[model samples]
Target: MIRLKSPSEIATMREAGRVVARTLAAVAEAARAGVSLSELDELAADLISAAGADPSFLGYRPTWASTRYPGVLCLSVNDAIVHGIPDGRVLRDGDLLSIDCGAYVEGFHADAAITVGVGDLDDRARHLSETTRLALEEGIAAVAVGGRLSDISHAVETVARGAGYGVPPNMGGHGIGTKMHEDPHLANTGRPGRGVRLREGMVLAIEPMLIESGRDRARTARDGWTVLTGDGSRAAHWEHSVAVTGDGPVILTLP
Candidate 1:
């Protein structure tokens, strides 16, 4: 069931979102070539704990996974699209890293992700990252009272397609609240005027994952949790939890 949050509840969610945003910022600032992905995870864990918020991804196990997620953040690199488990591997130059993190505070949850290029990035990598960011911005802009979910999807698809990027199929965004994942799945590509209608107090996570090559074909990695582009092309992902408000879309996950 889709639940609409009250103003007070939205305020609490914003606090949770801030914790996630701050943690991600700290991690991004600390992320550098030669730094181990596991080390970044440690930094995020400490930051979340110090803020009195719990790491939502730690110990999380999806139905298909045999083991619980062992880190506080997902460190997806290059072809690894999402759910890349943080290991002792150190980042290298020209690597595109996508870090996804979540925080649970005051009985609410907020989730966000960002993709960044390490040390010296090439032109293609830089363009992919920028495109994903803009796609997310476009998606967020479509969240408003009386708007349909497809309005957001179309906005995101228009940006990606215009940039000659491929929107990943099946994987997209979702509603977020007390639980890490909730109702109202938001697809990256869709026809406008379709799907759920937006309403005040509704919160949605608008994430756009784009592939620089081929259309949206993905494969699960050997790790069983990580997803990668089937064509082995580079991919970028950006996400933000937004709430529909009386005025417009309010990005809850902001630092």
Candidate 2:
């Protein structure tokens, strides 16, 4: 069932969302060349704990996963699209890094992700990251109170496809509330004016994962966590926890 947050409930979620936003910003700042992936995760864990919030992704095990997620942040680098486990791997200059973060506070949860280049990036790397960010902006703009859910999806697809990028199949956004993942899966590509009708108080996480290969094919790592582009082309992801309101879409995850 789709869960809608009350005004008060959304307020609580906003608090959690800010926590997530702050944590993500801190991690992104600390994400530099020569930094280890595990180091980033540790920084995030400490920030979340200091805020009296819990790391939403830590120990999380979705049905499709063979093991619990072992990191506070999903640190996807280069072709690792999502769910990249944080380990001893040190980052290098010019690596495209995607950071996915979530936080839980006062019975609510917020999720968001961002992609950044570790250092000076090539033209293709910078373009891919910017396109993903703009796709996220388009997706969130389509989250009108009375609009259909697919409107958001189509907006994302338009931006991504227009740039000759590919959206990974069956991997996009979702409803978020008390639990991290809720009902009503939102695909990154869909026909506009279709699917569930939007309503006030409904919160959605609109994330767009793009592949530079212009193909949807992808593969999961042997560890059953990290997702990689099939042809080894680079990928980027961006997301925000949004709430449908009478005025318009409210980005809860804004810092």
Candidate 3:
């Protein structure tokens, strides 16, 4: 069931979102060539704990996963898409890194992700990251009271498709509240006037995962967590937890 958050509840989520925002910022700053992905996970874990917020992704086992997620951050590199486990692999120059993190504070949860270039990134990698960010912004702008949920999806699709990129129809965003995932799955492509009606107090995580090949298929890694592009092309992901209010859509994860 879709549940609308109360004002007090939204405030609590904002606190959680800030923790996530700060953690993402710290992780991004620490991300560079020669740094192991595991080190980034450790840094995120410590930051989340120090802020009095719990790491939402740690030990999280979704219905499709064979085991619990073992890292605080989902660090996807290069062709690796979302859910990449932090390991001993060292980042290289020009590597495209996508870091996803979640935080729980006062029983509410917030989730977000960002894709960045490690060092001197190539032109294609930089363009993919920029397009994903703009797709996320376009999705957010489609969220409004009384609008259909698919409007957001359609907006995202317009941006990605126009750029000759591909967005997996299955993997997108979701409603976020007490739990990291909730109702109303937000696809990256859909009919604008279709799907659930948006209402005040509804919070959604509108993330767009884009593949450079214009093909949406991906493969699951042996770890049962990391997902990579089927054509071995690079991918980018960007997200924000937003709340629909009478005034407008408020991005809770902004620092």
Candidate 4:
């Protein structure tokens, strides 16, 4: 169901969103070329626990996955598009990392993601990361009162498509609130002024996953969780939880 949050509820969700933003910021700062993905997960787990919140991603079992997710965060690297488990892999210079995190606080949930290039990244990786971030910002800007959900999707798709990037068709953003994923799915490609209409008190997570080459096809890894580009091209993802308001759209998970 699509739930419209009240003012008090939105305030509480802001707390959860802040925790997500702060956690991602800390993780990004600690991430280095020599660090292991497991180490980053450990740091994020500790931070979430210390803040009196629960790691939303840990133990989450989506319908398609064979087993529950075993990590506190989704750490996708290079060709890994999303849901990359944190294991024994160590980061290397010029590697692109995509970190997706979620937190549950006071019974409310907030999710966010970011893709960054490791030390001494090449120009191509840098461009991919920046474009993904800008696509997210543009999508968020389209989330306003009386606006259609496709406005948000169109804004995102235009930016990525115009840049000659491919957006994965199967995976896109969605509503976020008491649960991690909710109603009113947000696609990256769609006709403007279509889909559900935006209204005050509605919160949505706007995420754009862009592929560097080939079509929008994706495949799951043997691990049963990680998603990667079928053509083995590099991918970038960025997201933020946003709330529709009378004034405009408020980004809940900004640092």
Q: List the residue pairs that clash in candidate 1.
A: none
lDDT of 2: 0.94
As a TM-score, model 3 comes out at 0.99
Give candidate 4 regions above 4 Å deviation: none
**Residue range 81-158, candidate 4, lDDT tens digits:** 999999989999988999999998889999999998888889988898899999998998888899899999899999
- lDDT by residue (117-235, candidate 3, tens digit) is 99899999999999999999999998889999999999999999999998865899999998889998999998899999999999999999999999988989888889999999999
- Candidate 2 has a TM-score of 0.99
Instruction: Please identify which of the two predictions, 1 or 2, would achieve the higher lDDT against the true structure.
Output: 2
Pull out the clashing pairs in model 2. Answer: none
- How close is every model to the real structure, measured as TM-score? 0.97, 0.99, 0.99, 0.98
Model 4 CA lDDT for position 28: 89
lDDT of 2 by residue, 141-192 (tens): 8989789999999999999999999888889899999999998899999999
Q: Which residue window of length 10 is worst by lDDT in model 3?
A: 164-173
Which of 3 and 4 is the better model by lDDT? 3
For each candidate, the alpha-carbon lDDT, in order, equals: 0.90, 0.94, 0.94, 0.91
